[model samples]
Target: MKILQSKYTNSFFVLLTVTGLLSSCYKPKKHFLQASGNYVLALRTQGTNSTTDYLLSMDTINTASKNISATGNGIEQLAWCYFGSTGSTVFSFSYGTNNVGIGYGVREGGGLYEKGRFSFERMDCFGKGDDNTLVAIGAPWGGGSYDCQIQLIDATTMSIKKKKLTPLYMRDGSDKLNKWPTSIVVNDNKMYVSFYPLDGGSWNTDLTDTAYVTIYSYPAMDSLTTIKDTRTGPIGYYGNQVNMIKSENGDIYTLSPSSLAAGYTQVTRKSGILRIKNGQQSFDPSYFFDVETASGGAKVLSATYAGNGLLVARLQIPGSDDISKLWAAFDVTIPICKIAIIDLNNKTVTDVTDIPVHGGQYGAQGLVEDGKVYLSVTSTIAGEARIYAIDPLTATATKAAKIEGLEVPAIYKIVN
Candidate 1:
């Protein structure tokens, strides 16, 4: 009887402990996903189609420690989104699956706060209208309609201030094609958008001979003139990238990557760079940088303005000779690109030797701090994702903090 009583008592205690532990887990407690720091970086894991991304904030990203994993860290995003920053705020704009844009701000008290979120029908490309506004362009991926949507989000209110549905430039009635926007740049009182013409149904870029840029009056959505340059095939690719950058003096420089790997159906023209002198509506007549010839036929995938009329660009290695792989460029799992510093003034390409060959990323904004350019790369050769600081003048690279993920989608500094 004593043994039976002891066994019952022991079982009852075990049950009580289990219930207490479970209750503690279910206790009402506030769960906050705030990180401590002044800088934010988007660490993306897995592939792009169905991706899992995390926005982690840290005090510094230059520590040469072991790989910094994004697992079990920071705020998990609502959906797959690309980043667009204005001032001290970072926005996660919806990609393919969802239609929402979430904003996060670096708090003065050392943690991040969910600033706000906005929704729209679609937002494919982004442009910084100013310090307070973000311009988003929404083009259809596949549909019977050709109408595009544009929205301007005010950072102060975290809501879209204005929206318009109109075509940047109307296509000829006889041409059954669609203009797909790759990048948007707002300079002064004008807005410039780069696009490629493709068959809406088949996605065939048949007009592979000239690059196009449409101009619109700033803050006013109206049909403006479309500028065409025949030196390159097109200005950009499928996903919005930093293809066009405005220099300090207001000159708008555009990168045209007529490479099959960059979603071009065929490469009939040389990849190059063109400029629209500040406040002008046409490409400069005498300035043309043939990037394909300069880099021995390698096509540039993305170019970020590094300062002093220099662009830190990522060019495809062996430059996409294979036209068979339709979506080869977006498949970043394969390492097929390398970083190079391009002199916009001298038309020279210098390769960064220290950084290993890496893959392509959509909308890669190389963060410039002081004189060095910091870019996120997934070095499949090194078997890790990390940040590399490259000196534009010397064409050298140095490794920084390691990333424990597929890629660091963006590196940002937001001071409170």
Candidate 2:
């Protein structure tokens, strides 16, 4: 589609800090982890006007003696971005100001470098397509349009491969409103993009009693069908969190966080999980996991699939969802977020008691290695920013690496 190129290609924002080492060193996260790869962390700290992000490639993250700081240590992104990875490339989709996506890669053995970048119209949410494609959906705002611009990026060359202006299909077969996309999941040769009907002008989610996912053929990018399930409010929430995940057996599971904590004015249906069996285009009628009830009425904040029918989730503290404090769900000081393990198969929520309660998490993509997912845990009580290695099955967590900044929103292990 000939995506536009950024004019400021090699611009690097210099970051400085005067504080000394803020943490003590420990040991590697896992001894059995492979030694031939590098770990990349996108560290986000505050700037004058917006947040500043830096991609730091390091060897170890668990030791208190080792404090990793974004200061003069990594690739500084243009601005705050929504991140997602496919294959070896990590994409930083610029949000708020710039409409460009820049990709970073691991050096021969250690360090980070920019692979390429391309500008686009707008990409509100992101998904991984196969091993070489990064999919983005540019949804309209404020009752302006019904067309969602879908674009695919070739990770190899870091260019927009193709784009299509696909229109939304409402229940009445009339496009009077716009559907905002939450996430995209491509599996089994089909692309699944989940959305919720929204009145842009009113900014209220009127159709919040059903889940919607549109299926399209892969590579060919053909819209095959639109599927809806009334068991949940919608297949996703706001702030670009991943709402769907594909398991090992190729079954796609979608999470509907119909919670007011995530900016939903009214949550009609219960927050839940729905699945699409392998090689199928429709939701599995027999499966529906009531996550809201499982979490004891607390609103789900974020979730990342951790294989084997388990998901590492963050839930708000019961009775802490105060919409009056705008975006309080993510305001780390609120002390309302709890880390738990969700079993999709048995429909259970196991609370991990080792970690302290915090505000909320910003990253949607969790870094999983050696059967444990690495999460950036920041607790006001703990008094430090650290990476907690959580075992989904056991529902336990161990403080691994210490981060000197705010939080490591995105992490990736690049085996170059």
Candidate 3:
């Protein structure tokens, strides 16, 4: 295995002064302060055959100084991070070569300490985590025969708690060749797993105009029932976590991007948002937002809930697929197309202004904190990586900080 590393730093100091003179007495106050917490950035570097992953932590207020980095081998197509409550414990996932590498550490004294390492089968899709457990759904990476495995691991111990296997596919006995697990959410003693069915290939061109979510009772792994919706495609994509999010009000909302084209034919479907109300198993027939139409035909690539029934979304231009455009998706030289804020209540999308347009392998590269959404806007070739603070209410974006050397694809705010 080979390892590569790089670092850059920029810091800003804010000084506050107070002056007063009373009864022939003069007093002066001077102090410099920086913001608390650090922003964790996932940086991607493309090589001849694979892409390497790097983790960098920079002060939220100052990006110049006090930056730390962790380097690793090439990551698979998808990578994710889990931040603990204290903002110290972190778990990183890297998938490649028919296996998944698990890295765990704690942030201490302004650095990350590697505590342990583990491994899992290839193409394991991550599920949501609670206070104690982390779940992973396993399936075949390429089109082949394999049992769908579910592994529940103890979050703190990093040890397997339980493992269960289902049939080749869901219990429905469907003959679909590719049943890809997209996202998983555990709610009310049941685990909801969303899937995208393809004919039999790596590309998602043979996608059906339908949605499938299999519900299984937790811990027991007993098959409950499969929910179906012909109104939309899959709930989420392969490289995103925010596709299905639970709001503060307890309702669950999911976004779909059906943007694959088959041979001499295209899947003409409107990508939209679907909701599963709190305390319900099926999608609410009364709730649906046509996100594709809202964006004037642009498809939503990734999205995250930004409070108040609003979502900050990254959109791809219509017909921007690599197969159609004759360019590879992993080409770091591509620029981002657009960013917008979607209002679920009014079913509207307002484009955010004044951000650089760059292209990259897109995912849920956004985080919501203190009523603001922090997004990673990095270009593959033109400009440096930048973190933008977006106000969902005003639909405006302002540059927050910058990362040199690498294009950051994901950002997470970890409090200390």
Candidate 4:
């Protein structure tokens, strides 16, 4: 094991200067000490095989950690799923495939181990069940052209408990093609599934700005209604989790990137946040925070809610809409992202000072826990991959950990 220590600077002056300039003054939160727990970081190493390693560290600031490599098993692409209640078990899904893997036993001496491996047709997003079950949503590859499938898996035994499918169609009752599930959330015995209804499996500028979410009765998997909203493009993006989050009060909020590649034109709707009130299937008509407008023309790529109505977000500045630029932005090959903290209650956004504006591939890269928000800054522009611990209240960010020679794409905190 190697310890890659990051250089801590006396950069508090920068935050202090910025804090004084903002209308709503920033307040600092309590600092967290380096403690022993299960912390996972995903590194995407370049090679013909596209190898990815899930490194588990017992203590976040310590040098001791174990690596679980996914070199084979046809898992060239992967996405992290939600952590279980115990935080000892975590899940991940492979891109464009039916494969799902579970990593558990983080507290055991052997480090994190693969407890089970299973398959569904194809899944883009996942939700947690009240009875320790995992709900997966997506469509079958090369099949289910006009239908989306949902499956419930027993997380403890890794077995399929039930399955169902629903046909997708336009408002006029015409069959919708190339429509697939992007994200899902389970709340109060009901499941909400967000979908991207593409023109023909690809982006078209002429596509409507409206996105739809279908609500269903959980466990029974019966479709109740499909709701649409034109305020945002979609509830979530592909290849990322954590876009849709539920508050402690049972209200649900989701982000829409509305990226250029997603077929959102300048004249169309911009990226923002939308809320679904508790016990309501439709979006809150009066609630909306236009992130793009707040960022002075930048688009929101991803966001995660910090407790107390604060949301840490990654904003993409306006840039060329060329395909290559879009690919580079998605691959984190360029520094094009700005980290901002959004105040949901006040409807304000403030940029975090002292942190590098760099590129990160996934929107789920930010994790909030124990009064701290951990962000993975994975760009070669900084010369090394590092994680920053943000004090959301004070709006101050400090370099917490570093990964010496790997392009870390995501980080997860697991406690036993």
Best by lDDT: 1
Cα lDDT tens digits, model 3, 1-416, are 22222121010000000000101121221211222235555655544533345555545623324332333322222333222221334455553322334443435434344545567664346665565666777765556664578887666666667888864245345665566676777777788788776544433445557777777888687888777777777766554345676677778787777654211013546788888887678888998888887788876656778988888887766656534332222233555356788888789998887666665443435767778887766665435666677899999977776655345556665544
| 1-416: candidate 4 lDDT, tens digit per residue | 22222122112111122112211221231222222456655545443422333444434532213222333211222332322322355665543222445544454432455567676556555666654677776653333366667878776776677888776435556645556566677898898887765544333334548757888998898989988889877656555446777788888887777775333332356778888998899999999988878778776666667888887777776663334343334445567777888787887878887577776464346667778787766656667566677777887887766655345555666655
Give the runs in model 4 whose Cα sits over 4 Å from its true position.
1-37, 61-87, 95-100, 108-110, 140-144, 203-205, 261-267, 319-324, 327-329, 404-406
Candidate with more favorable, higher lDDT: 2 or 3: 2
- Report, for every candidate in turn, its global Cα lDDT versus the true structure: 0.76, 0.74, 0.58, 0.60
Candidate 1 deviant stretches above 4 angstroms? 1-33, 47-50, 95-98
TM-score winner among the candidates?
A: 1
Model 3 residue 272 distance off true place after TM-score fit, in angstroms: 0.6
lDDT of 2 by residue, 30-149 (tens): 111122238888787764534566677888765557666765567666555668888989888764344568887877777777789888777778888878888888888557888898
Error of 2 at 329 (Å): 2.8
Select the stronger candidate by TM-score from 1 and 4: 1
Number of clashes recorded per candidate = 0, 11, 11, 3
- Evaluated against the true structure, the overall lDDT of model 3 is 0.58
**Worst window of 10 by summed lDDT in candidate 3:** 11-20
Which lDDT value does model 1 have at 307? 92
Model 2: residues >4 Å from true position, as ranges?
Answer: 1-37, 173-175
Residue 345, model 2: Cα distance from true site in angstroms: 1.5
* Two-way TM-score contest, 1 vs 2, winner: 1
